[model samples]
Structure formats: structure tokens, C-alpha cells
Target: MNLTLSLAINGGTGTTKKRKQLLRDSIVVDDVMSCDGGDHHSRVVRLLQARERMMAKLEADDPRVAAAAPDDGSGGLRLMHLLLSSVAAAESGDAHAAAAALHEVWRRASFRGGDPAQRVAAYFADALASSRLVVRSSSSSPAAASAAPPTRAERFLAYTMFYQASPIYQLAHFTANQAIVEAFESGGRRRLHVVDFDVSYGFQWPSLIQSLSHAAAASTSRSNSHDDGDGDCAEPVSLRITGLGTSPDELRQTEARLARFASGCPNLRFQFEGIVDDGPDSGCIKVDDDATVVVNLVFPAAAQSSMTSSTREEECSALLARIRSLNPSLVFLVEKDGSGSGGNAKSRGRSSSVLPAFTASLRYFAAVFDSLHECLPADSAERLAIERNHLGTEICDAMASFADYNDNYGGGDDDHVAEPTATSWKQMMERAGLERVELSSRTVSQAKLLLKMKSGGCGGVGFRVIMEGEGGRAMSLGWRDRAQLITTTGWRSRRRSINKAFC
Candidate 1:
């Protein structure tokens, strides 16, 4: 979430920032840094007040005053301009101009909080407001930076809300399950072992277990060792998940939940083995030689890295190497897309400035906030929890660190839209000797159905799934016309899969 935290794992582009100033959205899931705690204080409110009166005076003659303005009707374009101008000013380090722009934006943005546009405005206002506080405090004031970081539990809860509210988490889990099933069926392996890198609440496994049971049940003709060789009944398929977690208690609770869920599933043999992650050696994860193996990488990170660009890349590369060693039949890469070129091949190899990259990143989150308006009612408690503890916290960290986000993503034309070295995640996977693979039509259809069902208002109008990369190997879930938000890609170790195919 921290702009300085080096956004990784995600790749795509909506529009060129140079031609239309529409910045690329990079998918980053870094830890949130401590905030100034003053953005919501009386001082920031006072700034908004002064700007309100000034805005009234200036727009008095203009027919497009806030009082008469419809959120997306008469004043939408103006409101958008205000946000863009403010971003441009902030990116250029003109704090005074940016503050003036933000004050006006905050008042108008706060007007129709329920409206999607207004919601986007309000979220951006919070981010820019926090960033302003950082600029003013200029370090020596410990009292000003006393904001508390959101706890692991809060993040987990928020992650759950994210899962329910959108296809973000589901896209990863569902697509990964497809490949896992393929692995199990290809070899007709009786036992399947999944090693999840970070199994926080174990929200990803229930659906998979259900799918496995249904598959096992449907194939009544399949041979079953326990059925006297009659073939009328199918034996329960063995599923053992080796889940990694940061806390033992969380691990226990997760195992219990999965165990209870699996009990209801028929023709299924399920067991969960929890391990205290503590960044253990990848080799430590035990795998039964007879069981097919898969790895789940939902927001993979090699430590909550705060290293230089080269160091971060090295760490990620090494992590991929470790995964390849596991020789997982498949590796699912799912990450939040909140920064970088939406999907421009031309700009995928260039570099970027700190503020420009962060400013451009705003478009992705804006679409997300706006789309949520369609997903849940304004009064929904789950929606509120998501906006506050989850999305809001991410915005704060990303915006607050923008001015200081100095890492060489390489350099090129100002508007050329660099994608962190031919894009970070994809390149690393290739270097790790992982071959890109396509997701199934079933996976694609289900994703579309999910978007339609969740954001049913106006038919989830513009939400779409786009297949990118050579041979269209990756998929991205995006809002409206911009196909940049969450990205999911499937991969397999080149050597392992190749040798297995020949054998």
C-alpha cells in the first residue's frame, strides 16, 4: 500500500497517461505504513471550510455551482477536472495549489457520498489530505504521525469483504482450482496436496473442496478400490492442504473451519495440516510423492519488502525459484491491480516518476470505489467496513508515501508508461522457468457471471475480463472501459510439466 513500498505482482493498462493523462493502475499489496492521524482532525476540516467559501464565491456566476450540481449530471466533468488538476499539481510538488484544489474537491466530493463518483472523490480526498499532512509536518513531529496501523484481523476481515463484494479473490481461487483439477485428473491421482503460501482465513478452499466432491460424485464409473471393483461407486478423493499462517491460533481456527466444511462434502477425503509460516525454507513443506501438488500465490511477497528495485526483483526471482523447486503442477498468481500501465505493450518497458506513477494509480482505485457503489447498498455494514478498514487504509498508505516513492523503474519518455521492466511479475515467472498457461472457458465465464451478479446494477455495465500476454495467457478484472484492477495468471514449471507429459 505504501507508494514507497514498491508495487509488484500486478500488470495492465487502461489508457495512456501521456495522451489523456489517464494513469496506469499498478496492482500492489504491500503493508500499510503509519499515517499522520491528522487528516480527519479539526485542522483539515478547517482547510475544507475556507475552500468551500472561496469556491462559492468563484462559482457564483457560473451556472455549475455545487448547490445546483447533480453528482454525475451537470457537475461531473468539473468534479473530475478538479481531481485531475489536483493530482497534476500534487505530482509537481505544488502543495499550496494542490491543497486549494483538494479543499474544493473535498466539499463537493463530500456532497453525494453515496454516489459512486462522490465516493471516488471522497477516497481520493482522504489520500491527498493525508499526503498534504506529510508535506507540512516535514518529519520532526512525532505527534503528528501517531496514526495506528490496522491490525492483521482487520485486514483479514477486510479481505473477506473484498472477497464477497467483488470477484477479486474468487477469480484467483476459482481459476487455480481449474488447473488443480486438471493436474489431479491428468494423472488420475487419488490424492491432491495443495501448499498455500498464505492461508489467512482459509476462505479459498471451501469452494475447491465442494468442486472436488461434485467431480468425484459425477464420475460414477470411475474405479474405486473400496467398492469391490464394481465401479458403481466412486471412492472419496484425498485432499490434503498444507496451509501456512503467521499465527498458530489463526491456523487452528482455519483448520477447524475447513474441516467442518469438508465434512459436509461427500465422496471427499480432506485433511488440513497447518504450519507456522515464519518464512520457513520452501523445502520444508512436505509433499507425498504420490499426491499431485499445487501452489497458491494470492499476493505473493518475499518478506514485506522495502528494498531497492534490484533487491526487490532479486527477492521475487528467488521466491519464484523456490516455488519452481517445489515443482508445483501449477502456480496461481493473483494480485490487486492498483498501479502501472493498464495494458500498453509500448509502455511496458519504460521507467516512471514517483508522483506520476502514484497519481496515475488513482484511476484504478477510483473505478473500484465506484464499482462498489453498484455492488452493495450505501447502508450495508459490510460495505462500510470494506471502505473504512480495507480500501481506506490502502489509499492512505499509497498516497501518504507518494512524494517519497523513489525507485528506478527505468526511464523513458515522460508519458511512455513503463511497466517495471517488461512488467515485474511476468518477467520473473519466465526467468524462473515457469511457462504461462491459459485459464479455461469455464473460469472466464464464471468470472463474468460473478461480475454481473455482484454488480448487477446496470448489468455491472462495464466490468470485464481481458486476456493479455502472448497467446493471451493472463486475465484481468476491470471496471467500465478500463481493464485494470485485479490480475490473475496461471503457470507451470516448464521442466516438470514437459517431462511429465512425455512420460
Candidate 2:
């Protein structure tokens, strides 16, 4: 996976002497440069030179370099430096050098254990050949224009890979489980109806199903104990999961997976129905009066939009209103906190720009890469596969399509816009007439425990969960002291009446 060694011995562009000279010059400049009163151009040049030095240091055999692994920021800085160098090279019209730099970046990122390095290397090499250094619109290439969307296998691979390093799925699982438990305890109906929006793979629901099954079993046992030789004390709690997805194959797969997980719980009767429709507005979602409904919106399709867009805002409001109309007992919202296709736009115009999106992706994935480095060995094949197939694609796409990167990356569609911030989501939910439900201390503790267990080998990897803002309703998950994922549960509250006076 070490690109430097391979490139050095192979027929690379630079001669041995010239390469050594470049390295020496970069080191000398790095040692001598200072940031005191320089113009913008000079400052940029100095920073690039410093980045070159950092890259060299990363490749060195020094113990200090190994000691400064990603958890400490040094390794992440080197990765960022290589990325920036690639961008700078591309900007300067040196496509060959830019491609080479990007190769090195992906090589280093592929260090975590997963698949064979050759597999990852082959993908990067092919990507370099097929795509230009800059991101191009789908219309720019007839091949891209006609390209089919990612298959279910490809989607599953990408998702499982991403989950290796990120705790997002786990956080969402915990949040959803807590919401379900609360709904069962507070609501009158024993039958729970869960409406999951865009339930890709249905990974989050299995744990909730299992938990409810166990709870039902315990309740049944207690009821039997209290029975005075009577036939029955109370009906067993039943679960009905309605999965929403756009693809029939994916929906079928989700239904099958959930059914398999539900089969083991004898005390809990479970039913699964998959709906193929756009979303809540499709008239597929049904609200039953006899059951307690829980709307699980884990990374809903609509949430992946630019909240700044008036059209998108209206759509989001409409979708929320539809869910509110269901009168569900609880709604679980889980989302990435960092900017990208899964983040919030601070202002209206900036959401479409490439630089901001790229910067956001960089900061978000840096912590992600660092966490992966901490948990897995440098040579782990799983880690390599995840980095190469998942995160690497994201970084490269961002670099190529600085502006409209999300659309370009997702193959020209608004369906994959950057994620909004937690604060922005809170505002959106409040406007939709949902009241924030503070995440329980038990849920927060479980989140912390999950992080601890995952990062135990790597000494925690600087994972922290915090309750932010007044009343502590906003719960954020952070890595390396930066909040990268935020999730909170909300419930529908009766609207407060507004007082009016006659003029």
C-alpha cells in the first residue's frame, strides 16, 4: 500500500537525483519558512512547501513519525497536505502530478486492514484513467450519462465499509431503540407500528426488534406469574414494521432481513411490509388508530438536501407535516453533523460552492480516518477496502467537483445533497411542530459505551458525547474533539395556542 516505494522504483516521471532534490528543497524551506507579514501568494507557496515537508516526514522511518499517528492529528495533517497538494497541482495544470499525489493519498488511506491492497490499487488506477482530475458533470461524458445507478451489492459494500470506521449506525440504533422503548412504555397500545422512511438495508431495525421481543417475553413471564390460574393476563406486545424504499429489490431485501431477525423471538409477533414509493407524500404511509406508531427517520432521503433552498425547505416541511399527520408517538432523527451531502448549509448561496463542501468533507472524514487508523492495524484488508471504495471516492469526488460536488459525486441529482447541521435540523423539526425529546441519560451512556468498546484497543480515540444547548436536547457525537455526528429524538406535541386581541 505504500505508493512512495512503488513509485520510486517504477518508471515514475522524475529522475532519482531530481526527486531527491525536490525532497531536500522542500525540507530546507519548511525548516526556514515563517508566516510573518507575507502576501497571499507567498503565503500560499510557503504552505504548499510546508505540506511537501510534512508528506516527506510522514514517509520517514522515524519513531516520532509513527508515534504521531492519526489520533494525535499529525497523520491526519499529512493526509490533508497530500490532498491539498493534489488540488494545487491540478489547479496549476499538472494533471500527472495531481493524479500521482491523489494515488499516494489513497494508498496511505488504504492502510487499514480489509481487502488486498492490489484490489484497492486497481480501483484507484482505473478511476484515475476513466475520470479527469477535476470533477465533471454527468453531461460532460456520454458514458457517465448512460451509466446505471449503483447496484444493491455495490450499495451494501459501500455501506458496510463506511460503517467499519463510523459510529453513525450504532448511534442511530441506540436512539431509535430508546425512542421505541419510551413509546411502548408511555403509549396505551401494546401493538407497535414502526414506519421506517427509506429503510436502506434495514440494519437499524433488527436491534430494536430484538429488544422489543425480549421485553415482550419478560412481560409475558411476569404476567403468567401474576395469573390466578387464569387463561390470560394481557396480550403479548406485537411489532409491525413498515419499510419505505424506492427500489423493490432493496425493499424486499430489507423485509427479508427483518423477518429473519424477528423469527427468533417467539413471544413477540412481528410483521413486515415493504412499500415502494417516493416518500411520505406518496400516500403509502398509513396511520392505524389501534396501534402506537413510531416514525423512524434514520438518514431519510429528504434530510439529505440543502435546507437553504426554498423548494427543498417546502418539501421538507411538507414531508414533516405528513409524518405529523400520522400522529406517531415518536420520531427518531439521525444525521451526520459535518458538512457534505449530509450537512447543513449555513447560508443560501454557499451550499452550492465546491470549496465549502470540500472543506467540510475534509474535516468530517479526517476524524473518520483517524478513528479507523486507531481501531485497525495499518495492513488490515477491511480498512483498506473501506477507505478505498468509500471514503476515497468521497474525497476524490469533492476535489474534482468543488462546486456542485454532491450532485457530481452522486451522478447529477439533488437526492444526495450535503447533510445539515443539528441546529438546523432542530429548527426544521420545531417548525414542523415536533417538540424535542431530550435523549435519555441511558442512551447517552450506551453511546459512550459503544465508542469505548470500538476504540478500546486504540485508547478511546478521543470519542466524546455531549448534550448541547439549553435544556440539553441537542446530543452530538464527536471525534478528536470535533462533533461529526448529531442525533436526537422528538415527539409530536400539541400546538400552543396563540393569543390575539381585537384592534
Q: TM-scores across all candidates?
A: 0.69, 0.69
- Which RMSD values do the candidates have, in order? 10.7, 10.0
Reference-based lDDT, residue 325, model 1: 63
- lDDT by residue (381-476, candidate 1, tens digit) is 777678767887766666654433332332223343223333466677888888778877777777777766766542355567777777767778
Q: List clash counts for every candidate, in order.
A: 16, 25
Query: Which segments of model 2 are wrong by more than 4 Å?
Result: 1-151, 154-158, 161-166, 279-283, 306-308, 342-352, 392-423, 496-503
Model 1 residue 42 lDDT score:
34
* Ten-residue stretch with the least lDDT total in model 1: 25-34
Model 2 lDDT tens row, 12-61: 33333333544453343233333354453454364355444434432331
